[model samples]
Target: MVATRAQLIWIPSSGVGHLVSAVEIAKLLVERDDRLSITLLVLNPPRASKSNPFAELLASVSSSTASAAKSQIRFQELPYEDDPSGLGAKSNMSLAERHKPQVRAAVAELTRALDSPPLAGFIIDMFCTPMIDVANEFGVPSYMFFTCSAAFLGFMFHVLALQDDEGKDLSEFKDSDAKLDIPTLVNPLPAKVFPTVVLDEEHRVWFLGAARRFRETKGIVINSFEKLEPNALKSLLGDDKIPPVYPVGPILNLEVTGRSDKSSEILSWLDAQPSSSVVFLCFGSVGSFHDDQVNQIAHGLEKSGHRFLLSLRRPPPTGMLRAYPEEYENLAKVLPEGFLERTSERGKVIGWAPQVEVLAHPSVGGFVTHCGWNSTLESLWFGVPIAAWPLYAEQQFNAFMMVVEHGMAVEVKMDYRNDLGMETKEIVDSEVIEKAVQKLMKADGHDEKKEKVRQMSERSREALAEGDSSHLAIGRFIGDVFKNIP
Candidate 1:
């Protein structure tokens, strides 16, 4: 029953979040159409070097699919320049400038890498528009995947249109005070609501390239349920000139089945606590904290008087994260003196936990997050309230939406970033965190808000359902965009 159709190649950028979402999309595409064979184009470094997660995951998925007799999904590992992991090398520049050139290179290289088996179309990460141009070069249609809200996408596009082609400066952005046309953004937004990259000249130009490249594509695919970003979605695609848009979202449900081993341990700890007594803290994959900010956060969490599970990635050289000072890294020492001991039976600190599984758990009630789009959708999907601590970019905008517009979360308004390093200022103290946690845990007047989330979740599900808006959009894309293009 293997019907041969045009091949679709998915080019997902590196990072845990992007990689996971890309896999989910690929899996869904294959599930919907057995005739659609997919080849995930993963970029890996040399053979001797540590295998990048992108390549490793692709290999694992390929092996698992084959063993399960679902051998239609395939993987191709593209070599990187110099080292297998240019992660460190890529980090040398600000995120705004790092990937444009690499994307351009990957385009030419990827085409050559797949010389014999012609690619039918491409589904590329929003940031990797250079590949879209490559698709155009070969007379193939390309689709853009915005792994965040249409609100974020609109903001990026507006900023790009405002900037000059050279992108050497952003004088126009600094003084402007107007809300961009993002759907459902009830709060009046200022120009500063966009990411820092949009405000800087260099970053502005780099992002412009990606957006421009996107416009050249056949359509856009978003990793959001239509209900979650209604206003933003309408603003971007409601216009006839914007090309097609498909909202196939909250894709976590597709691949997620149960808790992982680490998540189970965290859930067990949460189970012992009273209902809604815990605050689940997880910044996205790469959020870093200064020692001073970390100390203050520790102080605030301790003061909150709630059961807590705080997950940290590679900790820093000193303070709570330092491994050599293992004894001091214990909750009591790392936090205020009496704080951890008082809540000892209630709190736990783990490196990483199963985020979605933990979020869906009944014991968990609130989230302290970095405001990444995926995390935003997950929190809303699970009906968890939030304490937002935005570190960078549109995170500030997301915090505004959660606290001001949606009334789903409270923003922790402490200015931690400045040229002089993070000021030792603590805006909302532990008592404040504790109070917010209490209100969120309680039924209070939040039932209406909960209903809003529930309704949105339903809409999200509907969008991805067969013959629904997103499904129809994808179907239209296959018939209209990809079918006759070649």
Candidate 2:
């Protein structure tokens, strides 16, 4: 008599960042436990096309994973139809809501298939909480794969409490001086740095609803390690109402593939520079700047007098909801005149960056980032200090945690928000950028901070080692799935 393997279905958000993290965890689960087989139900963007990068990414992942043993990890593209009423373009949540029927059908077919593995559970992205209903219909447990910091998770719970438990209106805090005493952080959270979702009425309602649904899941699997976020993880674990929390990460996909030509150029340039001398600036996939802001940054790099590698992307056209950053055809139009020539000795500017490889380079000492959670973990994993420049979503909160709560980063502009129109409420001037870069790259000014990050990097690795915090947490999660198997 052979034992049956437990089957899990993963529904990740359409964004590359979220999908990549989900895929990494799915791979981790299958590799750690042979009794588990996972299927990722890939979601296509509303207006997906042949040239769509999301489709290409899914193809690349599927192709790469085709060689895995026994095909334990699989990718299934969920059928998507454009919303005729144009509601899908409104927000990611709305688009996910429209996919519930497809999800239900997919889950039902998987469960009913002959010789199918026993259904263990459904693992969903944070935005796909509506699919919890589909899980409930099948009488199987569901879990959320939170792609952000544990601190951000705690913050969302706090936001929900303020709205429901205390009947407090969250709108009043926008741009105000009010401070929130969230249990996740050591310091009080200033209202100004709140994630844009909490401030916007529609997004706030959607997020609060998601937070409420989070309690219905069996547990949450966060992509952050224990030592780096002890306070938040402890706070979450101690809470009785929230689902059981598992901190099994710093789960980064460190493999750098694709873009060989551009990556080779970037690496060759870094090879010639002095060790610990370059400041690498890269915002996340959708992060781009206005022409004026790009000019300021170029000037800033020139004045900072440090070697640099800048990944500059063109902003999406206005009113395009699902647009991505495009590489500039000619850099001279956006950058200052003679700027590239003047700094040619010490700087190299490119479009798309191989971020993980760049950070792993010895010549890279500091990072100027958009402070996305994935980027944050990557920087810490490589022991690179950060200059936080948050653009949108929950990034502002992430930046605050790095610079204010943890002392791992210097502030470039914590409150910067670039929305659909590529319009910014505030522009970080060249002087501010110069000073932040200087502070981040100075030899003696932040030795303590630098050492702290280096030590944290070691702890991050240790947490994932056998018998350590993250490893044990993954074991616990797998055990729970087995226990729940009927």
Candidate 3:
């Protein structure tokens, strides 16, 4: 058992992707050193729905008594009342900004309830940087944890610096077709694929405020590794650009539970398939498509004649299209007419899949993904290449980085947007879907792609091992926090 203890409290932003990253990194830190303990303060609103990931994460941790005890980590809910100051649905910046005051108050209340010696430090997610003030109030050091790739951070920093040096943002390039001049980028970002933050003026202001706040923190901990983003990491660390940078990453989907059971329908079907034969298409949990888009996907899969599994969610009530939940209750109803019947032999559709487990399976060959960092890292961890389809946020940039910059993915559409904001204005036709899937799973010269990804998978595993780069970064992070702890 660990003799001396140092507990650090981590507050993650309110979303599945952000919450999962914090939990994964928290587990990695504890595993790397038993003497370290973590208290995860999940921010759940009083009127939150069951769909919230915080409850699910806490349940998973509570179910694992042995692991929880061994790691000496605790979970707490930092419940708050909602404020209606920000706009709805699309922008994360609004939500993050609205939660600032409430989070500060909740954390102050929580500080009084703690019985142990004062916390070693605060590890706050980027979305919750307002909590850094609480750490300062108690004379404790605080660090920022970025949930996305280091490359995205590098680009955002460059953009922010540009705005200060010159009053122009990326929006100026929308008409001129200019490329951003960042140090680490070999090729410049096109005007259309610019991060949504710069496209919306309010978002740009929120992002600039967030970036300014990040500079105030003691240091930053990015969920990336040296090998994954060498130049981006180098540029960020050089010039003392954005506080002290610690690259501790390749933090994967370390679910407290094992893979889904063999008896589950999808897993059972996958077990019978030959090795590396099926393509798995899963977007993020909140991701789904329009009915027109869904139909096109079905047509494409049938044309390709490849075995596939696709995860789709029914559209929301107020969106552009109508959802047929009452009459045609099944997913087939949402697809193109007669499409499912035709592809029944080769395709399986589910509302949700055990994504991490499914990716780890031997029979899985490729992924049609939204290019979220979690999904990208998980795909690389399992040696599965991607058919990159980025819908929103920093995903377009991620697609660019993976397919163009890194050469690990085939492009479905990096700039695929149907509507300007949240809705799709046009459908990805059957021809585009068919071509992308074929290239990912069945193209002739695909062995090199497979071999490249498989090697990346091995490197990811090695990066987190005892003596690798990520492992050493974690060691340094721990030492920096507690080496002078009184």
lDDT of each: 0.61, 0.86, 0.73
Q: How many backbone clashes does candidate 3 have?
A: 4
lDDT tens digits, residues 1-486, model 3? 222667787887666777777777887778767777777777663232223344665667545633655636667765554544322223344444455565567556655766554467789888776777777866778889998888888877878888887776555754356667666666777766666666666557767777888888778898888888888888888957578888888877555266445327888878888887899998775566767788888888888889998878764445321111121258767887787777777778777678887898899999999888889999998889999998766788899888877888899988774223434477888999999999999656446767778888898888888889888988998877776344
RMSD of every candidate to native, in Å, equals: 5.4, 2.1, 3.7
Q: Is candidate 1 or candidate 2 better by TM-score?
A: 2
**TM-score quality measure for candidate 3:** 0.89
lDDT, model 3, position 54: 46
Most TM-score-accurate candidate = 2
**Candidate 1 residue-wise lDDT, 230-302, digit = tens:** 7778888766646577777777633344446876787778778777667888876545454445566677666
Clashes of each: 5, 0, 4
TM-score-best of 2 and 3? 2
Off by over 4 Å in 1: 1-4, 45-69, 82-118, 164-169, 172-186, 253-261, 314-333, 414-435, 442-447
Rank the models by TM-score, top first: 2, 3, 1
The best candidate by lDDT is: 2
TM-score list, all predictions:
0.80, 0.96, 0.89
Kindly report which residue pairs in candidate 1 clash with one another: 45-84, 183-231, 183-232, 184-231, 304-434
Q: lDDT by residue for model 2 over 1-486, one digit each (tens)?
A: 334688999999888888888888888899999889998887677653222357777887777666653589888898876755332123676667788889889888888989789888899999888888888888899999998999999999998998899999999987689999999999999987898778877667788988999999999999998899999999999999999998999888887556588899999999999999999999987778888899899999999999999999887666554467788899988999999899999999999899999999999999999999999999999999999999887889999999999998999988887652323567789999999999999888448789889999999999999999999999999988888765
